[model samples]
Target: MSDPWLMPDGKTKVDPFVEECRLDEIPFPVWFAPYTKGERLGDMLWTGGSGLKIASQRMIDALQDAKITGYRTFDVDVRDHAGNPIKGYVGFATDPGPTTDIQNILGQDGQNFVFIANQRVVEALRAHGADELDIRPYDPSEFD
Candidate 1:
């Protein structure tokens, strides 16, 4: 199969930042969890080349039942490549396939560090009866 990064004519499709930093070959995994006490406490939920495995329904149920709210999803910067902040959609694990597909594209490997602050996962948690959730933007500097 042809590489997504290559053009039909075989000239490399140059992503200035990606090429300069070799970001494409990195293995940065996706994460899901809440921000608490100015920290991101979560799990390495999925990885690229692994075909979109999301956290199970039982895990979500447990998080809700435990009253663990304030959830957001993001991925590690892996290489900390500057000026390439990743951007992507944020939604629940139970959201429809198309929604997840969009999110996957935005959060693809070797991109900037993507983050979804409030709203996304919190709404899902609220629907499951999480009452004390907070919505705050993730601070990338924390990783620095």
Candidate 2:
């Protein structure tokens, strides 16, 4: 698959900041730059990849419980830079059927990060030189 990092024409990419995190070792703190129009928190940590994975599994479980007749669901979780709960995370199934085609476009990895925060916090982080954003489909499923 093509590298999402190089495709910026509104296509999503992983937050380099999250990838740089040491998921298995030390704590990872990421600052969210508050620039969007309508958000609450100022700074926040996009979920680590592992966090996303966990959330994905939960989403799948929820789908199963509801008897949703679609792609296999998944779950993931993430914390903010200050070790606070993340806005949300996302996941897609690996089933190679047309029903799961959209999931394929979400990235074969079946994982993504969605950060949420108030504009002020984002502004502060930008002022403080925070870089690498994991911007993508900032949906309620992941951010709400």
| Most accurate candidate by TM-score | 2
Give the Cα RMSD of candidate 2: 15.0
lDDT string for model 1 (1-144, tens) is 765555445565534423234334433332323222332323323333323223334435645565444332222332112333223322232222333312322333432323342344555555665443334655657655
Overall lDDT per candidate, in order of appearance: 0.36, 0.36
Kindly report which residue stretches of model 1 are placed more than 4 angstroms away from their true locations once superposed. 1-4, 14-113, 125-137
The true-versus-predicted C-alpha distance at residue 6 of model 2, in Å, is 20
TM-score of 2: 0.26
> Native-vs-model 1 lDDT?
0.36
Candidate 1 clashing pairs? Answer: 86-112, 86-113
- Angstrom error at residue 78, model 2: 1.6
The 10 consecutive residues of candidate 1 with the worst lDDT sum are 87-96
